[model samples]
Target: MKKRLKLNLQSRLQIKTVPSIRLANFIELPEKEFSRFIEAVENNPLFLKLANPLTPEERVIIPQKFPGTRFSPHCFLSLDEARLADASPINLSPVLERHHKAIKLIRKLGLDKFQKYFIERTSAVLPEDIARILRLKKSQVEAINELMNEVSIHSEFYARSSLGTGHKISYIKVAKIEFDKDKNPGITFFSPRHFIGRYKIDYEKVEQLKKRDFFLSEDIGKLNALFGKLELINRRKNILYQTILGIIEKQKIFFVSGNKDDMVCCLQKEIAHKLSVHPSLVCRAIYGKSLELPRGEEKPIKDFFLPKKEYIKRVILTLFKEHKKVLSDNQTAVELKKTFGISASRRAVSNYRRELNFPSSRKK
Candidate 1:
């Protein structure tokens, strides 16, 4: 290999977030000489006001409790144990029961209803669909499902989501969703562990009584559901991010890949739809959001989300939708090149097409 010539020497700018500084320099100076200098130089009213003379509340060092040699009880005893002395009598059995109930309900009811409940709190189904699934009268299903919702009223929990992390957990409770579009439709009961007639309890009042030693067992349930919601949200976010990033990764070979990826092209709407979520939610995942990897670094979960190449996906989708015949990569490439002003060859088109999951337009 030939030796490379040296380029220009330059220094990169380093942004200092915080460096050393003194309180005396910021506020009142310890020395009179410095105070006089501040008074003379800072002519602006705000600065002058902030200087020695014209200020209203003069900075005074309040006498702090002198660092005593004597140790407090907390120093010798465990803080948690000390606090527990003042805490309410806790019956953990209730909390554990509520937790298990929530888990059982999700497992028994099936993921569809549980997932629906997680998101919207209610999912409507027609009478016939209900009958087909549950083998019950539409009326019975509606009553049963509505009864489940009443049994698991959690909308109230979401109303107070701004509380502490624990409190916020209490705010988004999970309940089995039950709705009948007809006069009465079949309802779903997910939890296999039925303490009472196919229900963890007959009603919320009875259920809420099992306080789990907390303010309300309902809140405890909410807390548990919130964890599941957060996990699901994280998973969805990662999947969306990966898809966007993956497209960009493969787009470099678009010329050779477009015609080969019909199924991949079908996912454009899916990817584009996710990028539009509130940005704060997106960043929320980035800060300390992590998962246990097979490699075990516990990498941030946000790394899964990636920016996708929107333009390329749009082109692929358009080509797939427009092409009626089962055209092979060469024919599809010709059509795309001729009509779309996209300069790509048959092989490249084939690769891209396969990636997009677009079925080949060729006759079977």
Candidate 2:
């Protein structure tokens, strides 16, 4: 009878679990409010910070504090207690430490001026030369340059907050370019947890709360809410990444046809349909995000999702350049189908050509 009661309680708790708030709404929040929200989440009592440093792969664990049957109201373990409980403390990555130091040095030396100097220079500038100009040590310059190169390739997302007259910027690694064994480029995404670390659940404390008849349901519901948001964000990001990869693979011919103007058409609705998600979710995932290409160009995530008509126009222009001679609408339409496997009516081709302001066959 006791075991049956316990099972019934567990089922009730599972059934009463509340859903998490929408990640889209959280992302679409204003900058100041968003920062505050992040601060609140990070400062929650359930999340205990680690005094000891953490390795890249290590996560902090919330230790059990009260061992006896009697449970204190303050059941959660303190930071000191957690540290003491941990037998093996992991050290932070040296590379990550150096990167942080470099960012600080750059901020102190004036980021605006440094960027201006680089932009004004016509030729490639060396780190030593930059250091000489900025009155910084060669090593410092080299470290700063290394961090800058990483940002240019991996693209860190910076959140800014007002600090008196000046502003303070904190960076988080969002996405990075990864290569396969074949040397083909792909994308790897990192969640906020990757940069800010997370605390493991204290199951002992949870069990105690339940035994004490404390309102564990409310706390569980809150946690479930957070989990829901994180899960949704991760799912949407994965779908978006896979959709982009699929587009690149299917449109290889468009990419390699020596047409610099031609770009992959990745509409949000189309991607959502292919991935079985809402278009609004895709928009939220892409909002305020930038991706860095292998060639060091940083473009907004939305730029990848060009309108279908724009892509078609670029292809038509490419076709015109390839032919090297004036072609009538009928001829252009035929060539598009034969060469690029794109079928368009002659009348539609004529409309697109006029829209591009290209001269007619007679005018040429």
Candidate 3:
């Protein structure tokens, strides 16, 4: 018989394990590298050629099993049980149908344009007249008008409650600072409160309808799906706020110096740690996302997380521009250590200088 190595349960339990190769690679990639990977996967001809075709039925997968159970469907009845009990499938609620129709109309009109038209009309204007003006059916217009009325009420309430605070009160429009051609710019902070208000409105509507015996079982499922969307939006909004805060906290000197060329660096790992999530999840959450800054400039979210090497290069460039006397690699490295708390070898500084196309001190 061949000799076999044996381990005690406690020894086996204490053995170290590593994450999967794919997850480890994802977590290790720098912001630029990860962005390039995403771009290649999305747009590269070779990857596109390798993509598998999807079937019509496989286009969307619907979950049939009930939550926390393995076998029971959401209907809670097997086909045999339903047949024995002579139970019928639940019908959609009329209220939910009307809500869907209004959503369809809103999509066609565009949310911003719809809101503009709605606000432009005076209080005296009737729903019927508004329907005629927009070339929409009267019922659809009524439904949308009702939803907007609730939104306006909620907006007013939040404005009053959140006054003098940093909290945002609206989410429908992208908040951006508008600058005059020759004047100071005004800032409008982004807020996601409208998502909560809309969710509350739907919840109240569903409750009222259920109390009146108007909602079918299927309507609850539909409403739950809608609520899930609102929750997702709220989660993304929080992640974005957290990422920005992390950047600001990590680059205090950059913001305080007020110099555009002042280099700032924020790593995804730091943000992931702050948010108590895996770095790969943070990367996935922000990939391909862009936001409008306070100064009216739009930038990719990943641009905020700079690699250590690139950030050091920018710092060296800024140092060169600030000082009139040309400094040798050793001197630059010393300045980096003294000013930015960064310790770089003279050789490394020389390499960075070369990469930045800056002349050496002797050449200068």
Model 1 agreement with the true structure over 199-242: per-residue lDDT tens digits = 01123432343443422434444533332322232233232233
> How many clashing residue pairs appear in each of the predictions shown?
47, 0, 0
For residue 334, give model 1's deviation from the true position in Å: 4.7
Candidate 2 weakest ten by summed lDDT: 67-76
Off by over 4 Å in 2: 1-23, 30-39, 47-181, 188-223, 229-259
Q: In model 1, state the lDDT of residue 181.
A: 40
What's the CA RMSD for each of the models?
26.8, 18.3, 21.4
Could you tell me the TM-score of candidate 2?
A: 0.50
Q: Give one digit per residue, the lDDT tens place, for model 2 in 31-149.
A: 33443454454345433221111221222232221111111111111112232233312322333455776756655655345443332221224456567778888888777656543
Q: Which residue window of length 10 is worst by lDDT in model 1?
A: 7-16
- Name the top TM-score candidate: 2
Query: How many pairs in model 3 have backbone atoms within 3 A of each other, for residues 3 or more apart or on separate chains, i.e. clashes?
Result: 0
lDDT of 3 by residue, 1-364 (tens): 0111122232222111222343444534433353344334323332221121122211111111111111101111111222322212222233334455554666677644564444333121445666777787777777875544432322211121112234232122222323334432322332222221111123454465567655456555565544443333333434444555455456445444545565476789978665655677567656544434444455455766888889899889888878966689999999999999998999999999999988899998
Clashing pairs in 3: none
